[model samples]
Target chain A: MNFDDTPEQARLRAEVRQFLAAHHDELAHGDGAYLEEPGHERVDELRRTQAVLFDAGYMGLTWPEEYGGGGGTNAQQAVINEELHRARVAGPVGHVGLGMCGPTILRHGSEDQKQRYIRRLLRADDMWCQLFSEPGGGSDLAALRTKATRHDDGWHVQGQKVWTTLAQHCRFGILLARTNPEAARHRGLTMFVIDMEAPGVTVRPLRQMNGHHSFNEVFLDDVVIADSERLGDVDDGWRVALTTLMNERMAVGGGGGELGVRSDVLVSHANRLLPRLSEERRVLAVEALGRVLVESLAARYSGYRLQTTLEKGEHPGPESSAGKLTAVRVAHATADLGLRLLGEDAVLARSRDGDWRWASAAASTPGIALAGGTDEILRNIVGERVLGLPPDRPRTPAAATATPIAESR
Target chain B: MDFDIDDEQRNFAQHARDFFSEQAGPEHARTLLAAPGEAAPGRRVLAELGFSSLTIPEDFGGVGAELLNMALVAEQAGRQLAGPSLTTAARVAVLLADDADRLAAFSEGRLSLAVLDGPPSGSRPSMDVVGATHFLALDGDDLVIGEGRVTLGEPIDATRGLGYVELTSSEVVAQDAQARWARARQVACVILAAEGLGAADRAVEIGLEYAKTRETFGRQIGAYQAVKHRLVDDWVAVNQLRSLVWWAAWAADHAPDQLPIAASAAKAYCAGTFETACETLIHVLGGIGFTWEHDAHLYWRRAKVDRLLLGDESEHLAAVATCTLHAADAAATGELQPI
Candidate 1:
């Protein structure tokens, strides 16, 4: 298992560093630390920086050049990501579109869909959200009751999707709905590219505990999606949705964690408290740091391990589930340590000097347990797909299982 | 570039697993535990398959393989959970990049080596010492190999073959033995961690099977979140252990700079992961797991011994912490520069 990048990869990384150096002011020094899911203004700032990245061919390093990418190896993509993360910039906007929706369209969408959607998505000219989960069924997404009746012109969809991030601003979404209710749950679904601005479609911002309004509850009432917008065959939505969700899992799992979830904060915090810490506390704090460090390393390396599998041209397999689970667990651990160390001040929001990152990371981690795939569902996926354990009963694979990290090889 | 095991390594690991499963597996463990004795058969198998000389340089008439190869096999040994001892690892390490002519003798089944690592002043229990003809003692800063008169002592891990050796005369193999000792320490950690990973993998596998088959509250216990989540944690740990073990093994070879830090991390992390795996398996197994006849306790006992065998988790963890602090200080003081 090699950790050092090859010379070619190193050269590419140097080039990327040079690119970032040229664009540092626009990328890293734009404003206060950008959140993972930034506000519209921050996203607009991110788009400008991402446009710089796109022009330099760092934005879509591994995607085919025909689709507005560099056509580079997966190693280059990994390097670009490492350099970007090292620079502390919020990554490009429209990650859902690029990582999940764009890839899914490239795979399952018709030729016209590819010609229309892929380049714009990669350039962050448009935004996309997943319209999969409903208020009735979440972890059990296959059991969703949204209706999509077939029409001569298109499919008329009526569904409510909760936890739809960026829907308030997105012009389009990947929607999953039941096209044939008489069939079995897994087989009766269809996937569509629904225009968010279409008639009878309404998006309401969901206020988070942290007072962030990034998540939205999207309501669809007979939303007429044109025939050209259908992603896959009617009543085969589960299969196409699986494609999108697989991309979603890898994007979420390997994308690292949300805002305020950086492990560095906790590490630096412990370092600061060390000189004054009592002997017992010193040992305790170091042990906790070591544990969290191990978890973080494990999560990071799990992504690398999965990347090797991608390089081998196989499906994402089970490690993404493990990655997702471990990522959130580490975030939770960071929060736990943050609270214990800060004591009464831990609950204070927007503390002086912006100490709220820790408290906010802790407060926002629960959303992770719900996002991507819920903890319980992810555990089941790991158990069944990764560990070869017998499922509670034989059925379709989890929505987030079997994706191959947005590339065929 | 790659973090996952290569196809060749995977095949090697598979072969090791098959050998252990067919030969020195749970049945073998039961046989040894019934009488509480040494694993002489396991020793013969190790020598027969050239596992004893895996890392011996080609000039010494051995495979000249790296630590990663050893880690793959060692992990399988742990998975089979029925090895006689990990003594082969120390012998391999002492002879790794060595000028010695011991590989042929070892591969030909003429010599068996036991590596005892601890303080040299006092007598401490040793492993891989049962019926061995050679001994390598890793004292604090000195590495010495000796032909010794020894007496065996009973150990909690009956298979480890713990004993004491009195080296009347010894040859100092390396004067500046720090590098050699570090390699030994790191490779040993990787081997044991591979074993830990093996134990973790099996314990979790057994627990998951039980969870699927065992019924409680009129349904399979695996249906319950409580049981399912425990197994998932074990599975996650196994992956973590697998990742670190591979990394530590890799560091032992190509990246000498990372060996100390990586080995400490591996040793520190694997100990708890292995221990938790056993305990959680027992939890999953319930009453049947508590019985003397059940195999869970054997792994649990091994985990207990392995955790403290190389100074406990916190000690190695402190090493990791110290390294981090030193690096940080070095950076601040300009003692070290970024690569």
Candidate 2:
């Protein structure tokens, strides 16, 4: 298997290197991919940085040129991501819009939706959040009770969605709601692009154990939506959602650099920290290092394999989901090990007095496992799709009997 | 750039599986063990199939192929638990190729070296030594090929016997013994790791197949998330195992400088994967898996034997850490030469 970069790809990588070198000072701090900051400020910073990347033609290199993308290949995208990962750039913006929502819209959105959303999303003009999982719907996502009864004007939506990442900053969302109660579980839903600022819409931040607020519970109390906002046909939301979900796997699977952090960094950290640790803890650290290294190498190359397939103009399919599964585990485990190795200073968000600031800052890593898809869901997908195993029994969803959300927790 | 083997290797693997399945496989392992210590039939098939000469150069009367082709044979052997590895001779033959007589004899299928499990133990046990004229051992940094004075014992895995070879009068095959040891060790790692991958693949298949029929709580076990997730993870591990095996085997032939770390990583990873998979196969097989009569133990036996055969998982992982981290640290400091 040849993984050598083509000359053109090498040239592009050099260009990206030069770009990052030039912008190193400005990008040394946070990229704000999370939602801890004010929505307006986050959006502003994202727009500015994204505008620079857009002008540099590094944004959406793999997307077709019609959507303001560079119309390059997945290899280019992989190179760009590798550079971005090396630079440790997070952002005040969410990648969901560009990676998931935008692609789904481009494939399924009406002409108006495509023209209105693709360019803006690519330019990071507006952050987007997904409103698919409801308070009652996680693993059994199709059993969501969010109702979108038909209105004379359009549809009046009433639902509460949980784990709505970036909803506090999002101007728009792809919302899934039950449109036909009489239809089968997966056949009765519809997808809509709801304005987060629409009347009766509310977003309440969910502060996590990481002490960060990256997720939100969104309440839709009779939120009115125009029929034009609908994505795909009525009762065809499952197909549209499938596109987003598949793209979500690709995004997460091929996400950043495989290991979130480099082995050199971990090695250097060990070289620095091991001297001060006790014998028992030193052994523990080595064990963790072994796990981290195995996972990092696997994830890094798995991502490359996915890119190879993507460069061949094929979707990553079920195999790529393993990347996300492995990555989320690695990211969280490394973070946990970092905090434990921090001795007494683990309570603080990070150390200004020490070197594991990045690791300590990984407090937010647990969120990654749930985002895109839960670990169990991904495992099931890998089992059923990749291994050709039988799907879980098609029993009715446990949440199918839940009462409609009354702004429930 | 593809991460998969070429179509030729894939086809060869199918042929190997077909041949071994028909003649010598896990079933063959049992039948062969009934006669214990009689490795003639297996050795004969290997010679006829040219498996023993896969790595020897054409000048020495061999197929003169690379480790990738050898890996296909090893993988199919592991998949079916088919006989002892003939890749052993192919490995040491390439390393000791300067010994023209030994190389010629091995290439002509008249000579073989029973490779030993060279842990730090003083009394190391050799394997597959039934009809071999010489025994090879790696003692510390020394590469010794023994000629006389051997002690035999019952093997942990009955398919192969164990023996101790005296190295005091053995030949020093190379002046740079450490270098030779490292080279042969990496190539051997490739072949064995591929076998581990095959075993893992087979374990996953066995588990999934059993899960489809074995019922618990009035439902097929495969329908349960507990069983299904374990099999899924096993499948994932098998994929990782294959990837690493391919990389190691590829590196052994094309990137020798990178082979040390690649092979160590493959060994470290595969050793664990194979053991875990074989254990899981027994778990999935339930009561019968524990019975000596069931075939599950044979795979488990081979997996356990293969793991500790070269070096245990921990030892290999230590090597992985040393080789990889040192290389990484060197690259970071601009000390490493380009691969």
Candidate 3:
């Protein structure tokens, strides 16, 4: 009910704002705009910037100090994120590694495993991707058919992972492979920290409709991983994956980007079209304006609620699915409105003066909807978890097992 | 920090459910609907149960409870699809609680009241407000409480008239004009929002159960992509509505300064969400949901009436805009923090 930050929280916010302000000029002058572009050069630049953040004690603010983190609360981390987002600085490119994989490893990885990877991940010396979903087991991940047979002093992994973001740039990955087909689908799986550069492993970039290679298809063929790389006990991979997935949900649900876009952009679009718009078109434009206002307010309130929840030490729950769904819906709706407001000019993808950059950004709406999880999958989560609806009937074991990994790979 | 209700609130909600289940059971509600004209016995039952006295101040010989408490009972009434006249009676009691004299009459079961009018253009009464000892009229800027002769809509029995009260004021019981209008609007918003919340809750419960049990294509209809998506959307809407309602109730209870903004947000969000939830539930239920014998229509009717109770969607939207603009102006002038 209380929306204002506490005194201590307010001080922390001020500190974060100060830090962002100090770094703002440097970031704005450097390869900041290139952060959203998909390229290895930008990834490398981001890694260097992440190291600077870590050196300044801002990276891993919510993580325990034993793992090369600041050992701060989630609220502090959220404040850091909000400030960084406000400053338009590119966030740590190792988000998947630090936020999800590293956290899972901290919970379940061996001491040696943590010692070797945690510091490197924080420093951005190494990048990571998730090798969980296969061609056949995206949503139904328990049905994965990836196999990792035992080998001398190690394990031989043979599988393909698809839709892995920045896999081509990753030095390591958290891989899920079936170690025992005799056990139940969930029980037989195991998690490992696989070296992406190991023999017989290949990563091919997959260009999305937006012409970005932000994701890739990873092929693991007889990729040998040391025993030290195993994340948890054999056949406990599903539990480890659960930890990563939970973090993934929170990270995705954490509202990012500009909290609210500039109203002037919208006003300018309307002003440019007001004279040309027909009477009916003007009416539609006004209605769209009303919708934009309501939706923007809704999104802000939702973000505020989430910020409050984080401040209270609650990890994002199934209710986070609502935020995810609303975010995508609002984005899509806003983008559509922008397109309509821009008339024929909106169809053009590129303009020499960047006048249509907003429209071009809107063009990536579908990709955003499908990125973290499909809109449909998010709905299922909301229904089953948030609403306490009954779980979907279990797919038959035979049919589930029959799914081919190649399709996902 | 606490998302779940406390033990006291939980017990209060449970007691409310029990009271309605016992007193306003399916058969009881059916009887009320079939006989909307009768007011004496129903009013007596409500007064004996202390429902009508909920909002009255303790000095007036009534239960002095917050609007939140009233909202709880209203929600339960909604779940049972209780008759609108009874709801209107509760609303009137809430409105009259601010006036010591009216509260005294309501506490004594001497004030039989109802909201009997429709929108501006409608000639006939949309709700049963007959046989009231006093009728409260909410004009644009005035509240006129008067004793009047009313037309009965149908026969609930001899003592009640399912009818509208045609105002024939012999005396002005209370007149605050602007203040009365604001109070009436707040009460209307709370009651209507609570009703919508109730309907949305029931629709979700029924839809989820049906999704689990009803099979199609060798799996529960809920297992289908189309149905699952729709059900999930309804779930989201329900959550949003719940949040807005609680915030609204809290504002109405403690922060009257924020009441205008909070109440409009609550009503607008609830109206839209409840309408969608009801429609989606019907679709999820498929052909069985469309039948007259099904209970879905009860919720649909309640949602429709609640949506229209206090200025429909557009009216609420305008209210939202006005409040938002005021907040913006205050923020600009450094009178309030920008939210």
Candidate 4:
């Protein structure tokens, strides 16, 4: 029941603080804005920073030692992450690469694949993005129409992937395409490591409503991928994809301070803004701020519960969905409170007097529910998986006839 | 580094759950409700479970377990709609730790003490004190245990009636009664919150179960997004409340400086969550949930009462706000407080 760190964890925390302090000037400042900002120079600097972190035994701390990780517990990794976040320093670059892609490779990839990819991914030599969502299949990801036909030497993939975050910056992507049209929706798909530079593959950035080029629409047309690049067996993409998606939820769900504005920033904003409002509005403002604070605490503590699960050497499952859902509510509440505090000034576009923070939050926070998984989809996961509720629809006839995915896993 | 209940605490909770299920379950609560003042059953089981002595020190003839350990039992008590017996005992034992004979008497069920919920200036309402002989109330800056005359009000939760009391004769329990009373209040908050958390957890489970089994329009109602998502939100709130209860319990046992803020947060959050959970339970249960026969109302009543007991949700939120402003970093870094 103790929350204090162990002696070993404390020592690691001190070391991490010292290391972060040493690289304070070189690190990305201001709470991970650089991770979303796409530029060759920014990415190059990020790559070098990641390499330095990997060298310092901070990156991939919880991965197995055989794969060049530090072979440390998640708690130790958590201490480093907390210190890094508190210091406003950048962690490993290419979050998709390190958090989702690298972990998928370690768990479901072949020995050769693990050997070739794990270290490079950790060091950010090859950045990664997920190409799971398509224009036809956002929440219904299993219904993706992406086709990957077999070839003599490799597989040729052709699909349009929407909401491909950081695709323009990524060198590779974990693509889920239908390798067998004859099979069930979930069964026919296959996961592959598609080279973003392959011929006929195009990455066009999507301008977000907040005017950030953080998302992309990747068009894959006759893109050739080597046979060895397949992440898992043919027609078993759903199982492999689950591994990556679970990690994505874990990252997004347990990802505190990474997703939303800090509560303190909002508190300060309230302190500054509340004095100008009417008595009625001020009371409403205080209530809104308090609600945000409460939800933020819920998100934070639930994240700790997730951390404790990882610390106990258990893979996070649907519990991560709850954290993700709570995190979204916190973000939404903060954004709503932000706008409420601004009064009529909230309608003004980009008022340089720090009013933009709230406006930007309002714009960007909605997209968070869309990312990782939609709020509705996540609730389904929490309801079905965590609470053992029945699925919304009966299994498809083909799925009913086929082996249950749970059994296959 | 472990921020979870250990196996011993878990076992204690299981034991509490088993005992409550066997003795003080909703059916028993209903029975007590039917017969107004039937001396709420299960005092022997409560004694056997050692709940009364849970927070009392060894010098005071008690197990001297952490407040968290007792909180686990409190959660179970809430789940079964067990009355406020343990809540009262927890506050009494903490406030009367210096009085060993009184602690033993309370533990052995020879003394029945109910905590008064009001200011020190005047008459206070002692909740769920149906057959209590004495009351622990604030007497102008001092915590006093006194033989009191009661005026029982029409309790919303008839299973545990509410009563107003006037101190007929009194004695200060401790030297530093005010400070000890503050600690007692914090302990009460955590235990009540834990109980609310348990009640919320059960209420959600009841909804989920009904959702899974009950069919509407050729499908399980839970299969629909509207019902299922609402149920999921209930589940999420229960989980969140569980985190707060654990954290507040931990703070009470290990971090006194952090206890006030943590306890207030737990109490505040637990009120809304528990109330929401009970309401969601009824809604998900559909028609059966609204009936007087249904156990959902018991939880609803408890949540309504618990919310305003130590302090209402808004008051606790205000306290949390003040604490956070005083130590702004505590709210930012949720767990990393400077001990």
Candidate 5:
């Protein structure tokens, strides 16, 4: 109920704001061109920025010091996020690593595994991507057909992971494979840290609808991963995946970008576009403005709630899905509105230069909705897990029995 | 920091549940709902169970409990659909909290009071005031109670049809209008929001169960994209409303100063969300849901009625605007102004 931060949190917020302000010029200048490019270059710049944050003891605020972190609390992390967002600083380009994989490893990885990866991941020396989704296995990921057989020094892994964000540049990845087919669909899976440069692995960047190479199709052949690289129990990869997925939901669903984006920027955009509109278009524009205003307010307050929950030592729950759902809807709506504002010019391409740039950005949103998790999948999760809805029916025997590789194509 | 309920509130909630279950079972609820006019038999049962005496001070032979305890019982009653007289009785107790003689009468089960304000539709016929032992009416700053004929509709579960009460203010007493309105609005908002919460929760359960068992297109309907998404959306809506309701209830019970904004927000959000959840449940359940036998209608009906009971969404929104902006105006102008 109390919206204001505690005195200590307030002081921390001031410190974060001060730090970002001091580094403002460097932060702003470094990412200028990459801001419009949805590719590994921007990600690399982001990683470099994260290194600066890590060196300054600001990267792992909520993680325990024993795990190569600052050993702060969740509230402190929220404070840092809010401040960084306010400063318009690009977050860690290795977000999949630092936000999801690192946290998952800290919690579920073996001590040796932790020691090997945690510090490097935190410092952005090693970038990571998730090798989970395949052409066949997506929302129904438990049905993955990827196999990993036990070998002398480790496991021989072979699988194709699609939708691997920044995989072409990633040095490491969290891979899920079928370790025991006899076990239940969920039970047979195993999690491992696979080296991207391993002999049998190939990462082919996939140009999405937006012409961005943010995702790739990663093909893994007879890649050897040491037993020490396995996270958690041998056949408990599902559990490890759950840890990563939970962190993913919290990180992505936390609606960080939505909160940090300046409302005035949008408002000014609307005002500039308002007078150029036809009467009918003007009405639509006004309605769009009102909707965005309400949505922005909701986003801010919801972020405050998340911050408060973290302050109270609670992880973001199903309720956090509300924030994500609202954000995507708002983003889609705003993007659509922007297209309307562009009117005849919206379809124009700034470049036949064959380079991915901001002019081609409008197409990225539908991918945003489909990526991380599709809106449909998120709704199911929110309903069933968060709202205690009934479970979906199990897939039929034939469908269930079909391997993901055979079914996907 | 404490989002979880404290030990005392938890215990109080548990006690309220136990008491209401024992006192307002299905049979009692059915009988109360079937009762006619102002002098229903359930009044004695309510009095015996200390429902009418909750707000009365200790000297008036009442338990003198917190407003939160009353809210808990109201919520449980809503969950069970335990007749409208309980809400009316609760409102009466709130109205008579500072009136010593009325509190004594209510405590001893010798007098009964029915709130003259009808449902939010504003279409109720003038109430018959003759039979009521006392009629409570809002007249500016005064609560005028006199012998009058009271005509009431049959109660159905936790809601009854409109009652027309004619009052003769033989004993007219003046109180602070704003204070009375504030107290009355708080009680109304809490009870109505509780009812909406109960209906929405039940609707989700019903829809979810139906989705699991019902088969369509060689798969359980729950697996279908449309059904799952709708159910999920409703679930999200219900949970959000639940959060707002709890926040409003807590504010009303503990921090009266914040009641105006909190209650309005709670009422506005709860009414809209609960109604949406009800409609979405029907769509998810499809044909069978529309049938009266499915129990979906029970919640749907309750949500529809409860939404307009305290005040509709628009009313509350206006109230919020008035409370927030008008108060800001007064403060800015350095003048004492009443909304």
Candidate 6:
């Protein structure tokens, strides 16, 4: 087993480094936080930055060239990812368009849909957001209430989606709606591509505790989508949705600073704060930081394992769940250390000081757990899928009837 | 770059696992627990499998495989709760690379060896040393090889023998061996951590298997989130340690500059993770787990001993913390690239 990249991979990494150095000003900075901008200027900047990567052929390193991908090896793709991560710049697009939606479409979309969407998606000519999670269904996504009815003209979609990221800026959405309510919960759902600016579609930003509006509450009031836009089969949405969900785990498992703060950032924070801390506090801080460093390294090495699997052309198993969970756990621990070091500065949310970055990171971590999957759900996935443990039995009507009596008692 | 062992090493590990299962599996370990006076019961089989010469030089009539191959077999050895024969022989063979006669005898299973590592003074505990012929030890910055008087300690995890030794006659094989000792300790940490990982992996599997079949309150206990999540967390810890172990072994072979920090991280992390895995196994097994008939305690004892074998978790963590800060300092000055 080896840790160092091969000569070819090293060359790819160097080329990426040279490209980033030459085009740093044109790319998204601070790990793509600027891409979350709520204005037209940010959209324009995103397109420009994405065009740079698309032009450089850095986008879609492992995707087929027929679909505007680089048609490269997974190791080469991993090298590009590592370089991008080291440069602390978000890649060509966010997780929604590049990581999740594009991959789903490439796999399950019709030939026409692939021809129409994949290139634009990769080029950021059209931004995308996922419209799967509903107000009533966050972790239980298959239980969504969104209804898409058949019509001669198209399908009319009516449902409310909460936590729709970048909905206001996205040109399209990869949506999951109930197509056959008479069918089983998972079997009845279908995946669709709906225009975000279509009539009767409204996007309202949700203010987070961190005071960011990165998420939204999207309302679809009888919005019409053409029949050709539907992805996968009529009732095969769950399978297609699985494709996206799998990619979501992989995307989040990569553990860029955009999802949550990286551990190296916390190490730097600890180093900067250690001298000012009292000797007693310093000991506690170091101990806490040690655990973070260890787990962070674990998360990283876990990513390497996943990359190895990909290189061998095997589908990653529940290792992604473990990786995402470990990343979130590291984020929580890193944030806790940040708050402890800040003491009073943690509460000063609007401060312009460097200490507030840690505070911001702490505040934003809850969203990380909510994204892709919650902590409990991922643990259940790991338990059942990875460990081969029996899954939690679904609650039956009889059990629900008895629950009222137990609650009253 | 691959982060996994090659197919040959993988097949060898599988062969080792099969050999241990038929020869020195948990049942055999239980018998050893019943009789702590037994020397390394699997020593002859271990040498037969050629694990004894995994890292020794080819000139010494050994396989001359790298450290990672030794680590892969060490993991399998840990899984079956085999004796410390593999650990002691692998370590001693590398430290005595210059002694062709001893190396050949060691490779041929004529020279039984035990190893001791500590601050290099007074008495230090060595495992599986009840009937070994020679003892290799560290003595205040010097590496020593000699005959020693062994006083057997009461067996806590009796899958292997444990004893403290006082060297009667010895020679300083290497003077001022601080750097070599550190490297040797790092190698030990990697091997022990790999062993702990193997044990931890088996313990979790056992727990998971029992959870699937063992029923409580009219349902399989695994169906309950509390039990399932605990098992899942333990499984995650196992993965964490597995990655660290692979990286540590790889670093030892291919990236010596990264070995010290990588091994410390693996040792520190594996100590806690392995214990958690064994504890989770016992908890999942419920009452039967606490009984002597159960193999859970064997793993528990192994974890407890391995945690303190070279240094405990906190000591290794301190080393990790120091390295972390130094790396950060160097990165700030652009002396080293931050990973």
Best first by lDDT, ranked: 6, 4, 1, 2, 3, 5
TM-score of chain A for candidate 1? 0.90
Model number with the top DockQ: 6
Native contact fraction (fnat) of model 5: 0.15
Each prediction's fraction of true contacts recovered = 0.50, 0.38, 0.14, 0.63, 0.15, 0.74
- In candidate 2, list every pair of residues with a backbone clash: A31-A90, A31-A91, A32-A91, A32-A92, A33-A91, A33-A92
Put down candidate 2 lDDT per residue, B220-328, tens digits, no spaces: 7877788888888778777777777787788877777778767877887887788888888899889988987777878887777788767767666666655655666
RMSD of each: 5.0, 3.6, 5.2, 3.5, 6.8, 3.6
DockQ of 1: 0.49
Model 6: lDDT to the true structure = 0.79
Per-candidate Cα lDDT values, in order, are 0.73, 0.73, 0.68, 0.79, 0.66, 0.79
- Comparing candidate 2 with candidate 4, which one achieves the higher DockQ? 4
The local lDDT score (0 to 100) that residue A196 gets in candidate 4 is 92
Where does model 6 sit among the CAPRI classes? medium
Deviation (Å) of B84 in candidate 4: 3.2
Question: Per-residue CA lDDT of candidate 4, range B239-313, in tens?
Answer: 888888898888887888878878888889999999998888898887899998999988898888888888888
- On residues A294-377, what C-alpha lDDT tens digit does candidate 3 reach at each position? 454454455666666676777766677677677666666666676677677666764334565455456566776776667777
DockQ of each: 0.49, 0.51, 0.21, 0.62, 0.14, 0.69
lDDT of each residue in A1-409, candidate 4, tens digit only: 7778889989999999999899777666553232144567777887888887888898899888887888988888889888877776655567898778888888878898888878878878888999999887899887788899999979988889999988988888899998987676788889998889989899999988877777899998899998899988999999999999898888885544447666666776777677899988776666666667777777787788778877888997877877888887887787778777777777885554855666777778878989989999998998888788878767644565374333432
TM-score of each: 0.90, 0.91, 0.81, 0.93, 0.73, 0.93
Q: In candidate 6 chain A, where is summed lDDT lowest over 10 consecutive residues?
A: A400-409
